[model samples]
Target: MDLALYHPAAGYYTRNRTVIGPRGDYFTSPSATPLFGRLLARQLMDFREEMGYPAGFAVVELGGHRGQLRQDVLLEAPDLAYQVVEVGDPLPAGLVGCFLSNEFWDALPVHRVRVAEGRWQEIYVREEGERFADEMGPLSDPRLEAYLDGLPVAWMEGYETTLNLQAQEWMVQLGQCLERGFVLSIDYGFEREEYFSPHRPKGTLRCYHRHTLHDDYYAHPGEQDLTAHVDFSALIEAGRQAGLEPTLFTDQGRYLVGIGQELFAEIAERTAGQFSRERQAIHQLIHPSLMGSAFKVLIQKKTS
Candidate 1:
Protein backbone atom coordinates (compact mmCIF):
# COMPACT_ATOMS: atom_id res chain seq x y z
CA MET A 1 0.00 0.00 0.00
CA ASP A 2 2.76 2.43 0.94
CA LEU A 3 4.71 1.74 -2.21
CA ALA A 4 1.61 2.10 -4.34
CA LEU A 5 0.73 5.49 -2.85
CA TYR A 6 4.04 7.06 -1.82
CA HIS A 7 6.90 5.52 -3.76
CA PRO A 8 9.39 8.24 -4.68
CA ALA A 9 9.32 7.36 -8.37
CA ALA A 10 5.79 6.52 -9.55
CA GLY A 11 3.57 6.44 -6.47
CA TYR A 12 0.25 8.22 -6.59
CA TYR A 13 1.44 11.17 -4.47
CA THR A 14 5.25 11.32 -4.69
CA ARG A 15 5.16 11.39 -8.48
CA ASN A 16 3.28 14.71 -8.44
CA ARG A 17 0.07 13.34 -9.85
CA THR A 18 -3.15 15.33 -10.11
CA VAL A 19 -4.83 13.36 -7.28
CA ILE A 20 -7.21 16.03 -6.07
CA GLY A 21 -9.87 18.56 -7.15
CA PRO A 22 -12.35 18.46 -10.04
CA ARG A 23 -9.60 17.54 -12.47
CA GLY A 24 -8.26 14.78 -10.28
CA ASP A 25 -9.35 11.70 -8.34
CA TYR A 26 -11.16 13.29 -5.40
CA PHE A 27 -12.35 16.66 -4.05
CA THR A 28 -11.21 17.65 -0.58
CA SER A 29 -12.85 20.38 1.45
CA PRO A 30 -10.07 22.83 0.68
CA SER A 31 -10.79 22.20 -2.97
CA ALA A 32 -14.52 22.50 -2.37
CA THR A 33 -14.31 26.11 -1.18
CA PRO A 34 -12.01 28.73 0.36
CA LEU A 35 -14.57 29.32 3.10
CA PHE A 36 -13.49 26.02 4.67
CA GLY A 37 -10.03 27.43 5.26
CA ARG A 38 -11.41 30.78 6.36
CA LEU A 39 -13.42 29.08 9.07
CA LEU A 40 -10.39 27.03 10.05
CA ALA A 41 -8.40 30.27 10.21
CA ARG A 42 -11.02 31.58 12.61
CA GLN A 43 -10.57 28.46 14.70
CA LEU A 44 -6.83 29.01 14.72
CA MET A 45 -7.35 32.61 15.77
CA ASP A 46 -9.49 31.38 18.60
CA PHE A 47 -6.79 28.96 19.59
CA ARG A 48 -4.21 31.75 19.47
CA GLU A 49 -6.35 34.01 21.60
CA GLU A 50 -6.87 31.24 24.13
CA MET A 51 -3.15 30.66 24.40
CA GLY A 52 -2.70 34.37 25.13
CA TYR A 53 -1.54 34.94 21.56
CA PRO A 54 1.80 33.33 22.11
CA ALA A 55 4.63 34.66 20.01
CA GLY A 56 5.73 32.63 17.03
CA PHE A 57 2.78 30.30 17.26
CA ALA A 58 2.92 28.36 14.04
CA VAL A 59 0.38 26.26 12.16
CA VAL A 60 1.86 22.95 11.05
CA GLU A 61 -0.12 21.06 8.43
CA LEU A 62 0.58 17.43 7.55
CA GLY A 63 0.31 16.47 3.88
CA GLY A 64 -0.76 19.89 2.68
CA HIS A 65 -0.45 19.17 -1.02
CA ARG A 66 -0.62 22.12 -3.45
CA GLY A 67 -1.11 24.48 -0.47
CA GLN A 68 -4.81 25.06 -1.04
CA LEU A 69 -5.57 25.28 2.66
CA ARG A 70 -2.36 27.18 3.24
CA GLN A 71 -3.26 29.84 0.71
CA ASP A 72 -6.77 30.22 2.06
CA VAL A 73 -5.68 30.33 5.68
CA LEU A 74 -2.86 32.75 4.95
CA LEU A 75 -5.21 34.98 3.02
CA GLU A 76 -7.44 35.14 6.06
CA ALA A 77 -4.69 35.35 8.69
CA PRO A 78 -1.76 36.97 6.95
CA ASP A 79 0.28 37.47 10.12
CA LEU A 80 0.38 33.80 11.01
CA ALA A 81 3.22 31.44 10.21
CA TYR A 82 2.31 28.26 8.31
CA GLN A 83 4.40 25.21 7.55
CA VAL A 84 3.54 22.18 5.42
CA VAL A 85 5.21 18.89 6.21
CA GLU A 86 5.12 15.69 4.24
CA VAL A 87 3.99 12.53 6.01
CA GLY A 88 7.46 11.09 6.67
CA ASP A 89 9.31 14.36 7.10
CA PRO A 90 10.85 15.44 10.38
CA LEU A 91 8.46 17.67 12.32
CA PRO A 92 9.81 20.87 13.86
CA ALA A 93 10.65 20.65 17.56
CA GLY A 94 9.32 22.57 20.57
CA LEU A 95 6.57 24.26 18.60
CA VAL A 96 3.87 26.34 20.26
CA GLY A 97 0.78 26.10 18.02
CA CYS A 98 -1.68 23.82 16.35
CA PHE A 99 -0.99 20.63 14.37
CA LEU A 100 -3.61 20.57 11.66
CA SER A 101 -4.56 17.99 9.06
CA ASN A 102 -7.39 17.44 6.57
CA GLU A 103 -7.93 13.97 5.15
CA PHE A 104 -4.35 13.28 6.09
CA TRP A 105 -4.81 10.30 8.36
CA ASP A 106 -7.09 8.51 5.91
CA ALA A 107 -4.42 8.57 3.21
CA LEU A 108 -1.78 6.78 5.25
CA PRO A 109 -1.28 3.14 4.31
CA VAL A 110 -3.03 0.69 6.64
CA HIS A 111 -2.55 -3.00 7.31
CA ARG A 112 -5.46 -5.21 6.36
CA VAL A 113 -6.46 -7.77 8.95
CA ARG A 114 -9.07 -10.47 9.43
CA VAL A 115 -9.87 -13.20 11.93
CA ALA A 116 -9.70 -16.47 10.06
CA GLU A 117 -10.73 -19.56 12.03
CA GLY A 118 -10.01 -17.88 15.41
CA ARG A 119 -6.57 -16.67 14.33
CA TRP A 120 -5.49 -13.24 13.13
CA GLN A 121 -3.93 -13.09 9.67
CA GLU A 122 -2.37 -10.22 7.76
CA ILE A 123 -2.92 -9.63 4.08
CA TYR A 124 0.18 -9.28 1.92
CA VAL A 125 0.60 -8.60 -1.76
CA ARG A 126 2.38 -10.95 -4.11
CA GLU A 127 3.36 -10.70 -7.76
CA GLU A 128 1.41 -12.95 -10.13
CA GLY A 129 2.08 -12.62 -13.85
CA GLU A 130 1.92 -8.84 -14.11
CA ARG A 131 -0.76 -8.67 -11.42
CA PHE A 132 -0.89 -8.62 -7.63
CA ALA A 133 -2.51 -11.24 -5.44
CA ASP A 134 -3.31 -11.33 -1.74
CA GLU A 135 -1.20 -13.66 0.41
CA MET A 136 -2.26 -14.18 3.99
CA GLY A 137 0.43 -14.49 6.60
CA PRO A 138 1.19 -13.94 10.27
CA LEU A 139 1.00 -10.40 11.58
CA SER A 140 3.68 -8.32 9.83
CA ASP A 141 4.51 -6.51 13.06
CA PRO A 142 4.01 -7.51 16.68
CA ARG A 143 2.31 -4.19 17.28
CA LEU A 144 -0.57 -5.40 15.14
CA GLU A 145 -1.35 -8.02 17.72
CA ALA A 146 -0.92 -5.55 20.57
CA TYR A 147 -3.38 -3.24 18.83
CA LEU A 148 -5.89 -6.04 18.47
CA ASP A 149 -5.47 -6.94 22.12
CA GLY A 150 -6.47 -3.39 23.06
CA LEU A 151 -9.71 -3.49 21.09
CA PRO A 152 -12.80 -4.00 23.25
CA VAL A 153 -14.79 -5.82 20.58
CA ALA A 154 -14.67 -9.52 19.87
CA TRP A 155 -13.42 -10.67 16.51
CA MET A 156 -15.76 -12.53 14.20
CA GLU A 157 -14.41 -15.20 11.92
CA GLY A 158 -13.86 -13.93 8.34
CA TYR A 159 -14.65 -10.32 9.29
CA GLU A 160 -11.98 -7.86 8.15
CA THR A 161 -10.73 -4.42 9.20
CA THR A 162 -7.63 -2.24 9.13
CA LEU A 163 -5.08 -1.08 11.66
CA ASN A 164 -3.35 2.28 11.17
CA LEU A 165 -0.12 1.91 13.12
CA GLN A 166 1.43 4.86 11.31
CA ALA A 167 -1.21 7.18 12.69
CA GLN A 168 -0.28 6.24 16.23
CA GLU A 169 3.40 6.68 15.52
CA TRP A 170 2.72 10.10 14.03
CA MET A 171 0.70 11.08 17.08
CA VAL A 172 3.63 10.20 19.32
CA GLN A 173 5.90 12.31 17.16
CA LEU A 174 3.41 15.17 17.16
CA GLY A 175 3.12 15.08 20.95
CA GLN A 176 6.88 15.18 21.31
CA CYS A 177 7.32 17.99 18.77
CA LEU A 178 4.78 20.45 20.13
CA GLU A 179 5.78 21.92 23.46
CA ARG A 180 2.26 23.25 23.83
CA GLY A 181 -0.79 23.78 21.59
CA PHE A 182 -3.66 22.02 19.90
CA VAL A 183 -4.13 19.26 17.28
CA LEU A 184 -7.07 19.52 14.95
CA SER A 185 -7.65 16.58 12.60
CA ILE A 186 -10.35 16.61 9.96
CA ASP A 187 -11.10 13.44 8.00
CA TYR A 188 -13.83 10.99 7.02
CA GLY A 189 -13.89 8.26 9.66
CA PHE A 190 -15.73 6.66 12.51
CA GLU A 191 -15.27 5.70 16.13
CA ARG A 192 -13.85 2.24 16.74
CA GLU A 193 -17.32 0.85 17.39
CA GLU A 194 -18.69 1.73 13.97
CA TYR A 195 -15.37 1.28 12.22
CA PHE A 196 -15.13 -2.37 13.11
CA SER A 197 -18.81 -3.16 13.12
CA PRO A 198 -20.02 -6.53 11.84
CA HIS A 199 -22.16 -4.77 9.24
CA ARG A 200 -18.99 -3.55 7.46
CA PRO A 201 -17.54 -6.97 6.71
CA LYS A 202 -15.39 -5.91 3.77
CA GLY A 203 -13.80 -3.01 5.69
CA THR A 204 -13.31 0.50 4.33
CA LEU A 205 -10.44 -0.02 1.93
CA ARG A 206 -11.19 1.74 -1.37
CA CYS A 207 -9.55 3.07 -4.51
CA TYR A 208 -10.20 6.25 -6.47
CA HIS A 209 -9.10 7.13 -9.98
CA ARG A 210 -10.45 10.21 -11.74
CA HIS A 211 -13.40 10.38 -9.29
CA THR A 212 -14.49 6.80 -9.96
CA LEU A 213 -14.70 4.52 -6.93
CA HIS A 214 -13.96 0.82 -7.06
CA ASP A 215 -12.88 -2.09 -4.86
CA ASP A 216 -10.23 -3.43 -7.18
CA TYR A 217 -7.35 -2.77 -4.81
CA TYR A 218 -4.85 -4.24 -7.25
CA ALA A 219 -5.94 -2.18 -10.24
CA HIS A 220 -3.72 0.58 -11.62
CA PRO A 221 -1.13 0.32 -8.90
CA GLY A 222 0.82 3.54 -8.18
CA GLU A 223 -1.67 5.47 -10.30
CA GLN A 224 -4.80 5.57 -8.13
CA ASP A 225 -5.54 6.94 -4.67
CA LEU A 226 -6.04 4.34 -1.93
CA THR A 227 -7.72 5.14 1.37
CA ALA A 228 -9.44 3.68 4.43
CA HIS A 229 -11.72 5.21 6.99
CA VAL A 230 -9.75 6.44 9.98
CA ASP A 231 -10.45 5.12 13.47
CA PHE A 232 -11.07 8.25 15.55
CA SER A 233 -11.21 6.22 18.75
CA ALA A 234 -7.76 4.88 18.12
CA LEU A 235 -6.46 8.36 17.33
CA ILE A 236 -8.00 9.74 20.53
CA GLU A 237 -6.41 7.03 22.60
CA ALA A 238 -3.08 7.52 20.89
CA GLY A 239 -3.28 11.27 21.41
CA ARG A 240 -4.02 10.79 25.11
CA GLN A 241 -1.02 8.53 25.51
CA ALA A 242 1.08 11.17 23.76
CA GLY A 243 0.00 13.90 26.22
CA LEU A 244 -2.76 15.32 24.04
CA GLU A 245 -6.29 15.59 25.45
CA PRO A 246 -9.44 15.52 23.41
CA THR A 247 -11.43 18.76 23.47
CA LEU A 248 -14.09 18.15 20.85
CA PHE A 249 -15.27 15.46 18.42
CA THR A 250 -17.95 16.29 15.91
CA ASP A 251 -18.99 15.99 12.27
CA GLN A 252 -17.92 18.62 9.74
CA GLY A 253 -21.46 19.93 9.46
CA ARG A 254 -21.78 20.88 13.12
CA TYR A 255 -18.24 22.12 13.41
CA LEU A 256 -18.55 24.43 10.42
CA VAL A 257 -21.96 25.65 11.52
CA GLY A 258 -20.62 26.33 15.00
CA ILE A 259 -17.79 28.42 13.62
CA GLY A 260 -19.35 29.94 10.49
CA GLN A 261 -23.11 30.19 10.95
CA GLU A 262 -23.24 33.97 10.71
CA LEU A 263 -20.83 33.99 7.80
CA PHE A 264 -22.94 31.48 5.89
CA ALA A 265 -26.08 33.46 6.66
CA GLU A 266 -24.43 36.64 5.41
CA ILE A 267 -23.47 34.92 2.19
CA ALA A 268 -26.98 33.56 1.77
CA GLU A 269 -28.44 37.06 2.10
CA ARG A 270 -25.96 38.55 -0.32
CA THR A 271 -26.90 35.94 -2.91
CA ALA A 272 -30.44 37.38 -2.74
CA GLY A 273 -32.42 34.19 -3.49
CA GLN A 274 -30.24 33.21 -6.47
CA PHE A 275 -28.05 30.15 -6.25
CA SER A 276 -24.50 31.40 -6.35
CA ARG A 277 -21.34 29.32 -6.26
CA GLU A 278 -20.67 30.55 -2.76
CA ARG A 279 -24.02 29.28 -1.50
CA GLN A 280 -23.61 26.01 -3.37
CA ALA A 281 -20.16 25.51 -1.91
CA ILE A 282 -21.43 26.33 1.54
CA HIS A 283 -24.21 23.75 1.15
CA GLN A 284 -21.79 21.12 -0.07
CA LEU A 285 -19.62 21.84 2.95
CA ILE A 286 -22.26 21.77 5.73
CA HIS A 287 -25.20 19.85 4.36
CA PRO A 288 -25.59 16.39 5.95
CA SER A 289 -26.17 14.59 2.68
CA LEU A 290 -22.99 16.00 1.24
CA MET A 291 -19.40 16.10 2.52
CA GLY A 292 -20.59 17.49 5.84
CA SER A 293 -21.59 14.38 7.76
CA ALA A 294 -19.12 12.15 5.99
CA PHE A 295 -16.15 14.13 7.34
CA LYS A 296 -15.34 14.39 11.03
CA VAL A 297 -13.34 16.92 13.05
CA LEU A 298 -11.34 16.07 16.15
CA ILE A 299 -9.54 18.57 18.40
CA GLN A 300 -6.98 17.73 21.03
CA LYS A 301 -4.90 19.98 23.29
CA LYS A 302 -1.41 19.55 24.71
CA THR A 303 -0.20 21.78 27.55
CA SER A 304 3.12 21.65 29.28
Candidate 2:
Protein backbone atom coordinates (compact mmCIF):
# COMPACT_ATOMS: atom_id res chain seq x y z
CA MET A 1 0.00 0.00 0.00
CA ASP A 2 2.79 2.41 0.82
CA LEU A 3 4.63 1.72 -2.39
CA ALA A 4 1.45 2.02 -4.43
CA LEU A 5 0.62 5.40 -2.93
CA TYR A 6 3.98 6.93 -2.06
CA HIS A 7 6.62 5.47 -4.33
CA PRO A 8 8.89 8.22 -5.59
CA ALA A 9 8.01 7.14 -9.12
CA ALA A 10 5.01 5.37 -10.68
CA GLY A 11 2.92 5.96 -7.54
CA TYR A 12 -0.40 7.74 -7.21
CA TYR A 13 0.48 10.63 -4.92
CA THR A 14 4.22 10.78 -5.55
CA ARG A 15 3.56 10.89 -9.29
CA ASN A 16 1.33 13.90 -8.71
CA ARG A 17 -1.69 12.10 -10.16
CA THR A 18 -4.01 12.92 -7.27
CA VAL A 19 -6.76 15.09 -8.72
CA ILE A 20 -9.18 16.62 -6.24
CA GLY A 21 -12.48 18.50 -6.49
CA PRO A 22 -15.24 18.16 -9.13
CA ARG A 23 -13.11 16.45 -11.76
CA GLY A 24 -11.03 14.43 -9.35
CA ASP A 25 -11.40 10.83 -8.21
CA TYR A 26 -13.08 11.91 -4.96
CA PHE A 27 -14.28 14.96 -3.08
CA THR A 28 -13.27 16.15 0.40
CA SER A 29 -14.90 18.72 2.66
CA PRO A 30 -12.48 21.41 1.48
CA SER A 31 -13.32 20.48 -2.09
CA ALA A 32 -17.01 20.88 -1.17
CA THR A 33 -16.75 24.50 -0.04
CA PRO A 34 -14.55 27.25 1.33
CA LEU A 35 -17.00 27.47 4.18
CA PHE A 36 -15.48 24.29 5.51
CA GLY A 37 -12.08 25.91 5.86
CA ARG A 38 -13.62 29.15 7.03
CA LEU A 39 -15.38 27.45 9.89
CA LEU A 40 -12.24 25.47 10.74
CA ALA A 41 -10.22 28.67 10.68
CA ARG A 42 -12.65 30.17 13.15
CA GLN A 43 -11.97 27.24 15.44
CA LEU A 44 -8.23 27.65 14.92
CA MET A 45 -8.57 31.30 15.79
CA ASP A 46 -10.24 30.32 19.03
CA PHE A 47 -7.40 27.93 19.68
CA ARG A 48 -4.90 30.68 19.08
CA GLU A 49 -6.75 33.10 21.34
CA GLU A 50 -6.99 30.49 24.05
CA MET A 51 -3.24 29.95 23.83
CA GLY A 52 -2.63 33.69 24.02
CA TYR A 53 -1.43 33.81 20.42
CA PRO A 54 1.95 32.37 21.29
CA ALA A 55 5.10 33.31 19.40
CA GLY A 56 5.85 31.51 16.12
CA PHE A 57 2.39 29.99 16.21
CA ALA A 58 1.33 28.47 12.87
CA VAL A 59 -1.46 26.29 11.58
CA VAL A 60 0.47 23.28 10.22
CA GLU A 61 -1.59 21.24 7.78
CA LEU A 62 -0.68 17.63 7.03
CA GLY A 63 -1.10 16.22 3.52
CA GLY A 64 -2.89 19.33 2.38
CA HIS A 65 -3.28 18.56 -1.31
CA ARG A 66 -3.36 21.72 -3.48
CA GLY A 67 -3.77 24.02 -0.47
CA GLN A 68 -7.48 24.76 -0.96
CA LEU A 69 -8.12 24.57 2.76
CA ARG A 70 -5.09 26.73 3.47
CA GLN A 71 -6.24 29.35 0.98
CA ASP A 72 -9.76 29.36 2.36
CA VAL A 73 -8.63 29.63 5.97
CA LEU A 74 -6.09 32.35 5.18
CA LEU A 75 -8.77 34.25 3.35
CA GLU A 76 -10.91 34.11 6.46
CA ALA A 77 -8.10 34.87 8.91
CA PRO A 78 -5.47 36.75 6.92
CA ASP A 79 -3.14 37.20 9.85
CA LEU A 80 -3.12 33.57 10.92
CA ALA A 81 0.09 31.68 10.21
CA TYR A 82 -0.26 28.56 8.06
CA GLN A 83 2.05 25.84 6.75
CA VAL A 84 1.39 22.82 4.52
CA VAL A 85 3.35 19.58 4.93
CA GLU A 86 3.21 16.52 2.72
CA VAL A 87 2.73 13.07 4.19
CA GLY A 88 6.43 12.19 4.50
CA ASP A 89 7.85 15.61 5.06
CA PRO A 90 9.65 16.43 8.30
CA LEU A 91 7.20 18.36 10.46
CA PRO A 92 8.36 21.71 11.82
CA ALA A 93 9.56 21.36 15.38
CA GLY A 94 8.24 23.13 18.44
CA LEU A 95 5.03 24.19 16.73
CA VAL A 96 2.99 26.44 18.98
CA GLY A 97 -0.32 26.22 17.13
CA CYS A 98 -2.53 23.58 15.57
CA PHE A 99 -1.64 20.57 13.40
CA LEU A 100 -4.61 20.27 11.06
CA SER A 101 -5.52 17.57 8.59
CA ASN A 102 -8.52 16.55 6.44
CA GLU A 103 -8.97 13.10 4.97
CA PHE A 104 -5.30 12.55 5.62
CA TRP A 105 -5.17 9.75 8.18
CA ASP A 106 -7.41 7.50 6.09
CA ALA A 107 -4.90 7.56 3.24
CA LEU A 108 -2.02 6.14 5.23
CA PRO A 109 -0.88 2.63 4.39
CA VAL A 110 -2.53 -0.10 6.51
CA HIS A 111 -1.96 -3.72 7.33
CA ARG A 112 -4.84 -5.90 6.22
CA VAL A 113 -5.82 -8.60 8.66
CA ARG A 114 -8.48 -11.27 8.95
CA VAL A 115 -9.73 -13.71 11.56
CA ALA A 116 -8.60 -17.17 10.47
CA GLU A 117 -9.26 -20.10 12.79
CA GLY A 118 -9.83 -17.63 15.61
CA ARG A 119 -6.41 -16.04 15.10
CA TRP A 120 -5.27 -12.90 13.26
CA GLN A 121 -3.56 -13.38 9.92
CA GLU A 122 -1.94 -10.61 7.93
CA ILE A 123 -2.73 -10.14 4.26
CA TYR A 124 0.19 -9.62 1.92
CA VAL A 125 0.37 -8.83 -1.75
CA ARG A 126 2.33 -11.01 -4.13
CA GLU A 127 2.99 -10.79 -7.87
CA GLU A 128 0.94 -13.10 -10.09
CA GLY A 129 2.20 -12.63 -13.65
CA GLU A 130 1.91 -8.82 -13.58
CA ARG A 131 -1.12 -8.88 -11.29
CA PHE A 132 -1.28 -8.74 -7.52
CA ALA A 133 -2.79 -11.44 -5.29
CA ASP A 134 -3.44 -11.60 -1.60
CA GLU A 135 -1.25 -14.01 0.35
CA MET A 136 -2.11 -14.61 3.97
CA GLY A 137 0.70 -15.02 6.45
CA PRO A 138 1.53 -14.72 10.14
CA LEU A 139 1.36 -11.30 11.74
CA SER A 140 3.92 -9.27 9.72
CA ASP A 141 5.15 -7.58 12.86
CA PRO A 142 4.68 -8.11 16.57
CA ARG A 143 3.49 -4.48 16.72
CA LEU A 144 0.51 -5.42 14.57
CA GLU A 145 -0.54 -8.00 17.16
CA ALA A 146 0.17 -5.60 20.00
CA TYR A 147 -1.80 -2.83 18.37
CA LEU A 148 -4.78 -5.12 17.86
CA ASP A 149 -4.44 -6.89 21.18
CA GLY A 150 -7.71 -8.39 22.40
CA LEU A 151 -9.83 -6.86 19.62
CA PRO A 152 -10.40 -10.12 17.74
CA VAL A 153 -12.48 -11.81 20.44
CA ALA A 154 -15.74 -11.07 18.66
CA TRP A 155 -14.46 -11.23 15.11
CA MET A 156 -15.68 -14.38 13.43
CA GLU A 157 -13.75 -16.41 10.93
CA GLY A 158 -12.89 -14.60 7.68
CA TYR A 159 -13.69 -11.18 9.12
CA GLU A 160 -11.27 -8.69 7.59
CA THR A 161 -10.05 -5.36 8.96
CA THR A 162 -7.19 -2.89 8.61
CA LEU A 163 -4.58 -1.95 11.19
CA ASN A 164 -3.49 1.66 10.80
CA LEU A 165 -0.35 1.69 12.90
CA GLN A 166 0.94 4.67 10.91
CA ALA A 167 -1.83 6.88 12.28
CA GLN A 168 -0.66 6.11 15.80
CA GLU A 169 2.89 7.04 14.81
CA TRP A 170 1.53 10.23 13.31
CA MET A 171 -0.07 11.19 16.62
CA VAL A 172 3.16 10.52 18.45
CA GLN A 173 5.13 12.57 15.93
CA LEU A 174 2.72 15.47 16.28
CA GLY A 175 2.94 15.24 20.02
CA GLN A 176 6.71 15.30 19.85
CA CYS A 177 6.94 18.33 17.54
CA LEU A 178 4.14 20.39 19.01
CA GLU A 179 5.60 22.32 21.92
CA ARG A 180 2.22 23.63 23.01
CA GLY A 181 -0.85 23.55 20.76
CA PHE A 182 -3.72 21.52 19.41
CA VAL A 183 -4.16 18.94 16.65
CA LEU A 184 -7.34 19.27 14.62
CA SER A 185 -7.95 16.24 12.45
CA ILE A 186 -10.93 15.76 10.15
CA ASP A 187 -11.47 12.49 8.33
CA TYR A 188 -13.92 9.66 7.73
CA GLY A 189 -13.72 7.32 10.71
CA PHE A 190 -15.53 5.60 13.58
CA GLU A 191 -15.22 5.49 17.34
CA ARG A 192 -13.77 1.96 17.85
CA GLU A 193 -17.05 0.21 18.77
CA GLU A 194 -18.68 0.92 15.42
CA TYR A 195 -15.35 0.36 13.70
CA PHE A 196 -15.07 -3.15 15.10
CA SER A 197 -18.76 -3.93 15.28
CA PRO A 198 -20.05 -7.29 14.09
CA HIS A 199 -22.39 -5.48 11.71
CA ARG A 200 -19.35 -4.18 9.75
CA PRO A 201 -17.78 -7.52 9.09
CA LYS A 202 -16.14 -6.48 5.84
CA GLY A 203 -14.24 -3.58 7.35
CA THR A 204 -13.77 -0.09 5.83
CA LEU A 205 -10.98 -0.52 3.31
CA ARG A 206 -12.07 0.86 -0.06
CA CYS A 207 -10.79 2.16 -3.38
CA TYR A 208 -11.69 5.22 -5.42
CA HIS A 209 -11.31 5.50 -9.17
CA ARG A 210 -12.88 8.26 -11.21
CA HIS A 211 -15.21 9.06 -8.31
CA THR A 212 -16.45 5.47 -8.19
CA LEU A 213 -16.07 3.40 -5.03
CA HIS A 214 -15.00 -0.22 -5.20
CA ASP A 215 -13.08 -2.86 -3.25
CA ASP A 216 -10.81 -4.07 -6.02
CA TYR A 217 -7.59 -3.36 -4.18
CA TYR A 218 -5.59 -5.17 -6.80
CA ALA A 219 -7.04 -3.22 -9.72
CA HIS A 220 -5.16 -0.23 -11.14
CA PRO A 221 -2.18 -0.79 -8.88
CA GLY A 222 -0.67 2.69 -8.58
CA GLU A 223 -3.49 4.65 -10.17
CA GLN A 224 -6.47 4.21 -7.90
CA ASP A 225 -6.81 5.59 -4.35
CA LEU A 226 -7.07 3.24 -1.37
CA THR A 227 -8.38 4.30 2.02
CA ALA A 228 -9.81 3.03 5.28
CA HIS A 229 -11.88 4.54 8.04
CA VAL A 230 -9.90 5.77 11.07
CA ASP A 231 -10.38 4.52 14.60
CA PHE A 232 -10.89 7.67 16.70
CA SER A 233 -10.75 5.73 19.93
CA ALA A 234 -7.33 4.45 19.00
CA LEU A 235 -6.24 7.95 18.11
CA ILE A 236 -7.44 9.34 21.45
CA GLU A 237 -5.61 6.65 23.36
CA ALA A 238 -2.46 7.15 21.34
CA GLY A 239 -2.60 10.91 21.89
CA ARG A 240 -2.97 10.46 25.63
CA GLN A 241 0.10 8.27 25.68
CA ALA A 242 1.98 10.93 23.69
CA GLY A 243 1.24 13.67 26.21
CA LEU A 244 -1.76 15.11 24.36
CA GLU A 245 -5.26 15.50 25.76
CA PRO A 246 -8.38 14.89 23.76
CA THR A 247 -10.56 17.98 23.81
CA LEU A 248 -13.19 17.22 21.19
CA PHE A 249 -14.49 14.24 19.26
CA THR A 250 -17.52 14.58 17.00
CA ASP A 251 -18.79 14.27 13.46
CA GLN A 252 -17.83 16.98 10.99
CA GLY A 253 -21.44 18.15 10.67
CA ARG A 254 -21.81 18.90 14.36
CA TYR A 255 -18.39 20.53 14.60
CA LEU A 256 -19.07 22.80 11.63
CA VAL A 257 -22.56 23.67 12.88
CA GLY A 258 -21.14 24.53 16.28
CA ILE A 259 -18.59 26.88 14.76
CA GLY A 260 -20.40 28.28 11.73
CA GLN A 261 -24.14 28.35 12.35
CA GLU A 262 -24.31 32.14 12.42
CA LEU A 263 -21.78 32.51 9.64
CA PHE A 264 -23.75 30.11 7.44
CA ALA A 265 -26.93 32.02 8.12
CA GLU A 266 -25.31 35.31 7.14
CA ILE A 267 -23.77 33.78 4.04
CA ALA A 268 -27.15 32.35 3.04
CA GLU A 269 -28.72 35.78 3.35
CA ARG A 270 -25.95 37.44 1.33
CA THR A 271 -25.50 34.83 -1.41
CA ALA A 272 -29.13 34.54 -2.44
CA GLY A 273 -28.30 35.21 -6.07
CA GLN A 274 -25.67 33.87 -8.46
CA PHE A 275 -23.21 33.35 -5.61
CA SER A 276 -25.65 30.96 -3.98
CA ARG A 277 -23.45 28.21 -5.33
CA GLU A 278 -21.40 28.57 -2.16
CA ARG A 279 -24.58 28.14 -0.14
CA GLN A 280 -25.27 24.84 -1.82
CA ALA A 281 -21.66 23.89 -1.33
CA ILE A 282 -21.97 24.67 2.38
CA HIS A 283 -25.06 22.46 2.52
CA GLN A 284 -23.09 19.58 1.02
CA LEU A 285 -20.48 20.16 3.69
CA ILE A 286 -22.85 20.06 6.69
CA HIS A 287 -25.90 18.19 5.43
CA PRO A 288 -26.02 14.77 7.14
CA SER A 289 -26.68 12.98 3.89
CA LEU A 290 -23.55 14.37 2.31
CA MET A 291 -19.90 14.62 3.38
CA GLY A 292 -20.95 15.82 6.81
CA SER A 293 -21.93 12.55 8.46
CA ALA A 294 -19.30 10.58 6.57
CA PHE A 295 -16.49 12.59 8.12
CA LYS A 296 -15.41 13.13 11.71
CA VAL A 297 -13.44 15.72 13.66
CA LEU A 298 -10.98 15.13 16.51
CA ILE A 299 -9.11 17.80 18.43
CA GLN A 300 -6.29 17.16 20.89
CA LYS A 301 -4.19 19.58 22.90
CA LYS A 302 -0.68 19.50 24.35
CA THR A 303 1.19 21.94 26.56
CA SER A 304 4.88 22.30 27.23
lDDT (tens digit, per residue) of candidate 1 on 155-239: 6778788999999988888988889999999999999888978788889999999999998999999989999999999899998
lDDT of residue 230 for candidate 2: 97
What TM-score do all the candidates reach, one by one? Answer: 0.97, 0.96
Candidate 2: count of backbone clashes, pairs at least 3 residues apart or interchain: 0
> Residues 105-126, candidate 2, lDDT per residue (tens digit)?
9999999998888788999999
lDDT of each: 0.91, 0.88
Name model 1 segments beyond 4 Å from true. 150-155
TM-score of candidate 2 against the unseen true structure: 0.96
Residue 274 in candidate 1 has what lDDT? 85
lDDT for residue 80 in candidate 1, whole number 0-100: 90
| lDDT top scorer | 1
When summed lDDT is taken over every stretch of 10 residues in candidate 2, the lowest stretch is 146-155
| Clash count per candidate | 0, 0
